[model samples]
Target: MKNIVILISGGGSNMAAIARAAQKEAWQEKRGLRIAAVISNQADAPGLALAKNLGLSTDVLSHKSFDSREAFDAALMACIDQHAPALVVLAGFMRILTPGFVQHYAGRLINIHPSLLPAFTGLNTHQRAIDAGCRVAGATVHQVTAELDHGAILAQAAVPVLPGDTAQTLAARVLTQEHLIFPQAVRSFF
Candidate 1:
């Protein structure tokens, strides 16, 4: 069976969506896709508990414990390797991985960025979009690359930035689209 490992840092709504989709679609029996593990950099990450409830293995490798980004990434790589993941999915994983770590996973690594991408590459994307007076806001699932948020997009879902929308309201709508497209993008890996 092929293993898919998810890395998350927060509530992991995206990770939960993927797990739910895997179960609903019978990915294990149909595509030989199993969620081998869910790893978090923070021990208290809510997603870890969700993964546990779903019966998926979970681990935490706090970046704060490591002396440097490279050191932390090395340890993270080791943990991920233990699962022998065929694919590494980043669902709100906050760390900026080292170049070596990104290259290690390369084509097999993917991420779900909260903006249409190429537009808002880093944090505070929703607020930036709303400030810029954009008409559309959305999400993108793309192959992970050395450049932040600059990868070959595999899938995207666009939601209109409604009139008089605050950053919070816009983000909420985009998040809904994210839950829909991210799982589909993961399934496409098969």
Candidate 2:
């Protein structure tokens, strides 16, 4: 089976979705793939508890404990490599990885972003999209690159921004889309 390791910094809805999808017979029997671990940067992240409840191995390597981003990433990579993951999924892993870290998992790493990408590449995407009067907003599943969200797009799901939509409303809509597409993209990789 192809083992996957998911990195998260918050509630891992996307990670859970992908795990559930992989559990299906179509994926487990037809394609040999599995979620091996869920690692978080924050020890108290609620997702760690969820992952434990689902019987998945979990780890928390606090960024504060490391001397540098490089040190933290090195430790993170070591923790992930212990499982020998065939792929690493970033499901809200908020930290910016160093170039060397990104290179180590090149082509085998993927991430889900709240914006359609190449439009709003960084934080505050929902507010920015609404402020810019974008009629349509969406989520993107892409390969993680050294250039942040500037990666090869694998998939996207567009959601309409209503005239009265607030950032919270927009975010909620986009999150639903994210949960759907992220799992599909992971399945495609398998």
Candidate 3:
């Protein structure tokens, strides 16, 4: 069976959704796909527990323990390689990967960004979009490249920015879409 390794740094809502879909669809038996493991840089990340509860294997390799970005990415890559993942999914994995790491995964690595690509490429994407007075904000599932969020788009879901919407509210709506599309994008590879 082909394995999928997911990386997360926060509350792994997207990770949970993908795992759930994998379970419901029986990807292993049906499509030769299995969510082999979920790895996080934060030991206290809530998603680790959630992943465990979902019957998925989980691990933590704290980034704080590493001396530099390259060191951390090297260790992270080691942990991920253990799973022999066919695809590496970044579900809220909040770290800037080194170019070597990105090149190692290449087409196999993918991420779900909170805003439309080529627009908002970094953190605080929701607030940035709001501050820019954008009428539409969305999520993009794309390849993970060295140049931050400037990867090839795989799938997208756009949400309307309602009147008087704060970043929190808009994020909530966008997250709902993220939960949907991220899984869809993962399943597409199989």
Candidate 4:
């Protein structure tokens, strides 16, 4: 079976959702896909436990231990290469990867961003969208490129910015769409 490795830095709700979808969709039997591992740069990341509970191998290569961004990327690349991942999913992974590392993974790397992308590329997307008076806020699944959050979008799901919506509320709604679309986008890769 082809292997998929996921990277995360926090609670990994999207990772959990993808794991559930893989099982429910029988991706292993049907599409020859398996979640080979879940990795994090933070040792204290709660997603490690979630991945473990899902019976996936887990690894933590703390960025603090590395001398530089390149060093961390090299170690991370090594860890990921060991699995020979057919695809690498960034599920809330919070690091700005080196360009070399991004090139190494190239077309096989993908990420889910909180905004429609090309709009709010970096952080604080929800609040930025709210402040900009956007009527719709959404998520984008895109091929990972050296440029931050700028890549060929594979899929997107839009949610209306309801009246009186706070950033937290907007984030919550957008996250729901993220859960749905991420798994679908991953499946489409095969």
Candidate 5:
């Protein structure tokens, strides 16, 4: 089986979606994929409990405990290496990794971002889309690169920005798409 290690910093909605997919018999028989471990940068993150509930191995590598981003990434990489993951999926992982770490993972790492990247690269994506009066807002699943939200696109799901949509409403609509596409992207990796 192809082992996958997923990293998360928050609620891990995407991680849950992918794990659910990995549990399917057809997915396992056809893709030969399994979620081996879940690594979180915050010990208190709600995702950790969710992972445990799913019976997956989990770890916490709090960034605040480390002296530098390099230190955190190095330790994180060490934990990940133990799993011998064929693929690493960053699902709501909030850390900005150093170029060296990104390079080390290279094609093995992938991420799901909240917005159509290059358009809205960082946080507050839903508010930004609303402020810009964008007709469309969506999510992108892509290879993780050294640069933030700059990577090779794998798949995207777009949600139309309705006329009456608030940032919260738009975000809710987009999140649904995120859950769908994120799992599909991970499945593609295998």
Candidate 6:
């Protein structure tokens, strides 16, 4: 089976959504694909427990343990390669990947950003949108490249930015759309 390994650094809500979709859709039996593992850069990441609860293999290689970004990416790539991943999905993996690591995965790597990409491409995206008085904000699933969040768009879902919306409220709506479209993007690969 072609393995889809997910990397997460937080609660892994998106990771759970993709894992659930993979299980319910029987990706392995029908599409020759499966979620082989879930790896986290934080040893205590809550995602590890969530992934285990979903019955997917989990690993942790703390980025802090490494002295440099290059060292960390090298080790991370080694861990990921062990899973034989055909696709590597970054769902809340908060690190800025080294270009080498990005190139290693290349077309196989993908990410889900919180804001409509080509707009808010970095952290604090929701608040930025709200501050700018954007009437609409959404999520984008895209191919991974050396540039941060500027990758090729795969699938996107837009959510309206209502009046007096705080960042948290806006993020909640965007996350809901993320849960929906992320799984769809992954499924499209198979």
Return whichever of 4 and 6 wins on lDDT: 4
- Candidate 5 residue runs with Cα over 4 Å from true position: none
Give Cα-based local distance difference scores for all models: 0.94, 0.91, 0.94, 0.95, 0.90, 0.95
C-alpha RMSD values across all candidates: 0.6, 1.0, 0.7, 0.6, 1.1, 0.6
The stretch of ten residues in a row with the least summed lDDT in candidate 1 is: 47-56
Instruction: Report backbone clashes per prediction.
Output: 0, 0, 0, 0, 0, 0
Query: lDDT by residue for model 3 over 1-190, one digit each (tens)?
Result: 9999999999999999999999899898999999999999999999999999999999999989989999999999999999998999999999989999999999999999999887898999999999999999999999999999988999999999998999999999999999999999999966
Model 1, 1-190: lDDT tens per residue?
A: 9999999999989999999999999999999999999999999999999899989899999999988999999999999999999999999999888899999999999999989988999999999998999999999999999889988999999999988998899999999999999999999988
Per-model TM-score versus the true fold? 0.99, 0.97, 0.98, 0.99, 0.96, 0.99
lDDT of 6 by residue, 97-174 (tens): 999999999989999999898899999999999999999999999999998898899999999999989999999999
Candidate 1 segments whose C-alpha is farther than 4 A from its true place? none
Show where candidate 6 strays beyond 4 Å. none
Candidate 6 structure lDDT: 0.95
Tens-digit lDDT track of model 5 for 80-150: 99999899999999988899889889999999988987789989999999999999999999998988999
Please provide, for model 2 over 1-190, each residue's C-alpha lDDT reduced to its tens digit, 9 standing for 90 to 100. Answer: 7888999999988887777777654565788777889999999988898888777889899999999999999999999999898999999999999998899999999999999998899999999999999999999999999998988999999999999999999999999999899999988876
List clashing residue pairs in candidate 6. none
Error of 2 at 158 (Å): 0.3
Pairs with steric clashes in candidate 1: none
